[model samples]
Structure formats: structure tokens, C-alpha cells
Target: MKYFAVFFFVFISNVFFAQEKENGTLVNGIIKDDTTGNLLSGVNIINVNTVKGAISDDKGVFHLQAFANDTLHISLLGYKSIKVKVTNDWIKNKTTTIQLTQKAYALEEVVIRPYVLTGYLEIDAKLIPTRENYRYSISGLKEGYEAGEYSPNAFGRVLGSIFNPADMLYNFFGKKPKELRRLKEMKKDDTVKNLLASKFDRETISALLGVSKSEIAEIMERCNYSESFVKTANDLQIMDAISACYEEYKILKR
Candidate 1:
């Protein structure tokens, strides 16, 4: 009878442990602005398949129960949305922090005028001299509008007829050029962040490079990850960057 009771107890305990494991993990993380490094609240975070989610509090902390197979989608207004892959570390720490980059707004041929020309006709206006007057006028001759020659003014008009003011502005400014340095990486989604947090956590990174756990902090610093790389690179590209950084660090140390 005692042996049967012991067997029943072990079975019940194993069943409970299996149930907990099957329930998956409760993942938690903080949200922040990549550019300003400020906490973001009220951000939406949801698991795509499960639809289980949470919103960040004033402190940017949030929690949601999710499985490793789940994809957590995070988003906010004026910022790009991100998808984070659930990982064991996320389940363990329950306090991962992620920075969301703000989206850049490009002005499309903006012409801001305080005064409304309500009555005026929205049309191009040009004054041209009569033929005889143009022939005698110094301004017309200097302008290459001489009567006997091909009307340079006619060509100018033709060019202006097809001209796009936006194109002209772009030409002057060189293709709406965005200064990469001036442009903060608020646009990058969370693929890289998730990669860093999941794949390069202290344990994983330490094992990958055979580094001691005590040196993980120094290893992270030595890698010298850039904001742009974090924001822009795809998974494979980020991995390459990490590998390169690790190699360089080894060379320097030796």
C-alpha cells in the first residue's frame, strides 16, 4: 500500500511539472526610444499567433505569457513596429529592454505660405515684349530672344513647361539626401535587438566564443556595435557584424 501511494505521488508531481513546462514562459521586457533613450509607455505588444499581449506601463515595463514559437509584435505611433522572436533568455530574465526607433517623415514638395491667395489665380505669369519692341530692347537681346535667331526664350519656355519644381529642388539638394549620421536610427525594427538579446546573451555568447562568463561584459564592449548596424542590418548581416567584431577583438587582445 505504501509503495502504491509513493507511485501515485511521483506520478502527480511529474504531471504537474509537465503541465508547467507545456504552459510555456511568461516573457517580460521594457520599451524605450532609441534616439532619445527615454522610456515609452502605452506601446502595444502582442503575440501574433496567440493574440496574448500587454501594454507598457509608465516605466515601459511589460509582461506577456508566450511560447518560444511565438512572435511578439511591438508598435507605437510615429515609430516603426517590430517583431521579437521569443527565446529562453526572455523567458528567464522576464525583464528584457528594447529600444524602438522613431520613423522619419520626408516632406513632399512642401510650400508653406501663411497668407492664402484666395482670389489670385494659381497660375504661372510671365511678361513678354512685342516682337518689334523685343528687337529694339537690350534686355531681350541679352536674354537671347533676338528676332532673327532661334528663340532661346522659346526653348526656355519648353523646358519650363515640362519642369517639375520638386525635381529642380531635388537636383539642387541632391536627391533628397538624408545624412546617415544626422539621421537617427529610430526606424530599425527589433530583429537585431531580438538577436542580440536572444543569441548573444551572456551564456550563449560566452559559449559561442569560448569566453568566460566574467568577461561577457568586456566582450560586449569590445564588439563595438553601432546604432546603425543594430537598426538596419538583417539577421545574417548582424551575425556577420558580430563575427567580425569578435575577430577584431581577438586580434587586438593577442
Candidate 2:
């Protein structure tokens, strides 16, 4: 009877300790540039198992709750990514400092030439001429005229394309002066909306907005971005789009 009592107590204590260990602990850390020794802001720190994450503050500090043995992925733009384990010792230390190496890239060499030819006939605006074919631009234009090679129709069409009359008409429709300006603004807005949709997935949107997957659709729909607009904006521009759309979402909630 005595032996069984001790065995039962030991088993129960072990189970309780295991359960406590699984609950995880909060981890605090600072991220720095490996070489420069400067704090890195906006660094993404994510738990490999739970997907829970946090971004470093201006001081390059982050705190995240994670399992004791979970791996933390740390990443930032222009820096090499790294992973750290949330071991028992790390937790006991309360906070740790990690440095990330910068990713270096070798750029290709480039050669620059004159912008305009003095009298080159073979080369057009497209730069499609062969390397061996070269001449002065003034001489080329003079010869073209002497040979009666100039076509008014083609030249007129090219000039018209450069100075589009439709663009003038566009402003005329919108109170004359502001019509073109308004159209440009509308185009920019559409570009922003499409940029957000393309760069961010449903999960990413949820993470940013602090919303669930089901709520993302309605929020995105309210953004009013066209599919074509997304193809126009680049990565950096897309961040501005995300901020604008998030503000729009907040407005809708109000």
C-alpha cells in the first residue's frame, strides 16, 4: 500500500509538470545588425510551430510567447534570415540579443553611351540597330529629306501619338481643367487597391488587420481595387496601398 501511494504521487506530479511545460513562456529579445551593431526595426520574429509572430519595435526589441523548444525565425529586408531556439536557458535569461548578417549581392557591370546621336540614320528610338551600323543623326535626317524618304502621314501620326488629342478631350469632360487630374487620381487609387490584393494573401491580410479568415473577403471587397490595377504597382508602392486600404477598412468599421 505504501509503495503504491508513492508511485501514484510521482506519476501525478510528472503529468502536472509536463502540462505546465507545454503552455510555453514569453520570450524577449533584441535584434541587431551583425556588423554595424545597430538595432534593426520591423524585423519579423515568428514561431515555427504555432505561426504566432511579432515585429521588432523602433528599438529593435520584440517579445513573443512560444513553446520552450519552439524555433523562432527572424528576418528583415536586406538581411540574412536566422533561427533561434527557445530553450530553457534562454527563458531563464529573460532576454537575448541576436545579430543578423546582411545579404550581399554582386551587381553586373554596365556601360553607358551618349543619349542622342549627332547624325545616326540606322538607329531609331528603340535602339534596335546593329552595333556596327553607326552614323551622325543630323546627317541621317538631312539625307532622309534629300531622298524624299519623309512621309507626312507617318510623321504626323507619330507626333499625334506623342501629343494625344484624346488627353485634351479627357480634361474637357471634367470641368475642363481638372478632368485630366481627376482621371489620373482615380487611376492611382485603382492601382493601389490591386497592389494590396496581389501582394498580400488571405492569411497575411488577417495577420495585418487582426481579423479572421472569413472577415477578409468583405474587407477586401470594400477596397474597390480592379485586377488590372494590381499589375501596375511595384513592391514598395504596394506597402503604401496596404496602409491606405487598412485605413479604409477602419473607416468602414466606424
Candidate 3:
């Protein structure tokens, strides 16, 4: 009788553990931008009161296991974060799409002034003393972009590439007149941001902007630049933009 009772208890424990491991309680979802309806990759999702968490992949999909009453917190840069209560009913339904709204920058009471590089330098000299480090960082970022490394931050990478001063001059004077013209059209017509948003990563952006990276990839997709003039010009513009940002940072610091 004693042996039989012990055997029964062991069997029940095994069944309970198995059910916990392979139960109907699973949370799966996708994160996307509310305005554009584009999937947002690299968004972080965490359980608010627990250490459990996951990150959205390239396809913006995430899967996590939870019990009936767990709360999930979702966050991404440039967008407002959201918290959702997970119940048994929620888990049973599965397959959720969480929409994140974009946060608008408040422009009220803010003064708009023309961007003057020299004036920026004079002000920076008082603020940040480590100006040389900033320059070195930007220079390194330019080099990484030219070498075809993807940035980690999407916004930072696009800004770094588009605002590079050396690249602008090179395109103006280089051989690929047609390509340079296309770039100009993209810039003037305001399509550059969209193009980069669709393609760049945070690491790629950080590399382009002289910021730190959480993860780095060994390879990046090469830009389609067949014309020598276009290629040279684009490269120069990217490098120059990074330099310019660094220069401004130095000036502000001083």
C-alpha cells in the first residue's frame, strides 16, 4: 500500500510538469507602427512584474509563455510604450497585433533658429570638454558606413548618411552624375527617410552616427551604386555628415 501511494504521487507530479511545459497558455504577437502600419523590428517586450521578456524579430513577431494573469510591457524608440493585461482568455485567443503610436515632439514655446556651425562650436566649448573624443567617434562612424556596416539605430543611421558633408561634395563633383541627381531628387522630394526607415537597423545607425552598438553584424547589404561618380559622391557625403555632427557636438561642448 505504501509503495502504491508513492508511485501515484510521482505520476501526478510528472503529469503536472508536462502540462506546465506544453499547455494552452502561450502569448504570441506582432508589434507595428500605428501610423504607417509597418512592422517594427527590435522592439522590446517584457513582463511588467517579472523578469520574463522577449524581443521582436525582423518580421516583428514575438512569442512568450505565461500564466493567466501576467502583464506584458511593450516599448520602442520614437513611439509610446504600451502595457497589456494577459488573462487566460487572452492566451487562449492567441495571435495579437499591438499597435504603437508615434510621439510628436512638442514644438510650442521652442525657438527656431537657423543652423550656424560656427556659432554652435562657440557654445559647445563651454558645455562639453571632451570634444576630441566626439570627433574621433564620428570619424569612426563614417569609416564604418563607407565599409558597408549596418547601423543599429534606424533613425541615427539614415541621418548620418544623409547629412554627411563629404559625400555631398563628392556627389556634386564626382563621375556618377545620374546617380547623384537621383539622390538629390530623393532628398529634395523627402523620400530618403522612408527609404532608410525601411532598410536600416539600430546597429547600422549607431555605426553611422558614432554611437554604441548592442550587437554588431559581420556583413551588410552593399549599396547599388554602379556609377563611379555616384559611388564616390555618396561615400563622401556620408563621411562628411558624420564629421559635421561631431563638429557640432564639439562646439556645443566647448
Candidate 4:
């Protein structure tokens, strides 16, 4: 009887351990194309709440750290973006399959302008119009530069941002405290950084930051980021800009 009791206790402990391991923190998933039923690879999977990111392999499989109530943003180049909310059932099940529908792209009309440039350097320069811009620096900030056009009110706007950093970034980072808090987590993930570094589009950043593209531009502008950087920088650069600006704002608040 003693031997039997010991065996039963050991068996129960093993069962409990197995159950715990089965319901782990990682969510395993396979992605496929809805129309063709073909496995899709290179899909971007991001846990927006945690700011953890992963990419689907050639086998169309991906694993990401997620939990109940957290949301996952899945996207690819040609497919429609999807948001999957993690549920208690999903946590228990531990595996899922997602299908993405292809996005219908409509081509817009394009007008091609023929540029007639003479062989002279001065004449070619005259053919292209250039806008003059200026950068202003504010004291007591780290790497702060206000970019503005060569206009009458440009200096005043830059001065306003320099003097009142909080007001400039309040609309961008104030209301989205939960999302902004994940900035550090985002910077820690090498996969997320690589994904952002290669992409020019702000889609992933927008989803992670919970802001629109226009809002992102506006926020960066108010934070004294140069217009050239705001318009031309990669997603990783934009992420760094937001992180720096938010850190400055936090320090200023204290």
C-alpha cells in the first residue's frame, strides 16, 4: 500500500508538470492564404501589447510570446492586415491557424513630366526648385533639433516646441501611456528592430504605437524632428525618434 501511494503521488506530480508545460507563454501559429489555401511565409507577427515581434518561417509557422487579452497584429506585403485577440481558450489550446485575404490594389493615375535639362550645371540647377529650411537647437535637451521651412512663422513654431516640450508631445504620448510603456520592450527585440529597419512604410509602427501615420508625422514634427527625417527615415529611425522624445518628456515631467 505504501508503494502504491508513492507511485500515485509521483504520477499526479508528473501530470501537473506536463499540463503546465503544455500551457506555456508562447503561442504557436500557422498562417495561410485564404483564397489559395497555400501556406504563407514571411508574415510579420507582432504582439502589440507586449511589443514582441516574430516572423513566420518558410513553413508558415511562427511562435510569439503572448497571453490572454493581448492582441496580435499579423501582416504581409500584399495581404490584408489582421488583428487577433488572444483569448483564454487560445491560451489553453496553445496552437492556432490564421488565414489572410489578399488586398485588392487599385492603381492610381500617374502623370509623367518630362524634364528638359541643358548640359550646363547652372541651368540644371535652375530647372529644379529647392526649398530652404533651417534647424534650431534648444538648450537643456539632448540632440534636439527643430526643423522648419524658410518662412516668417517657422522660427516662432520652432521656438514654441523648444520652450514647451510637454505641450508638443502631450497629444502623441500622453493619452497612450500603456502603448508608450512598451517602447523599451520594442527596442530590446532584435527581430523587431530588423523588421523596422528594412521597411519604409509606417504600418507596423502605427499598429505598435496605436497611432495613425499622419499623427506620427505631426508628433515627430512637434518633437523637433526634421521634416526630412520625418518623411524619409525608415521605420526604425522613426521608432528611435519616438523613444528619444518620450524619454525626454518623462525626464521633463519629473
C-alpha lDDT values of all predictions: 0.50, 0.52, 0.49, 0.77
> Per-residue lDDT of 78-98 in model 2, one digit per residue for the tens?
787677888888888879999
Q: What does candidate 2 score on TM?
A: 0.38
Better of 1 and 4 by lDDT: 4
Models sorted by TM-score, best on top: 4, 2, 1, 3
- Candidate 4 residue pairs in backbone clash: none
- Model 4, 1-254: lDDT tens digits are 99999999999999977765554378789999998989999999888887788999998999987768888999898999999998888778988889999999999999999889898998999998675555534322356344443346634544455456466465566678888888778878887877887777898889998888888888877666667767767787777767766776666555
Please give the TM-score that candidate 1 achieves against the real structure: 0.38
**Residue 110 in model 4: shift from native, Å?**
2.2
Lowest summed-lDDT stretch of 10 residues in model 1? 132-141
Candidate 1's C-alpha runs over 4 A off are 1-19, 109-254
Which rank order by lDDT, best down to worst? 4, 2, 1, 3
Q: What tens-digit string does per-residue lDDT give for candidate 1 at 114-139?
A: 54344545432222222321121211
- How many clashes show up in model 2? 7
User: Over all chains combined, what TM-score does candidate 4 have?
Assistant: 0.74
Taking every candidate in turn, the Cα RMSD to the unseen true structure, in Å, is: 22.3, 20.4, 18.7, 6.3
Off by over 4 Å in 2: 1-23, 109-254
- When summed lDDT is taken over every stretch of 10 residues in candidate 4, the lowest stretch is 136-145
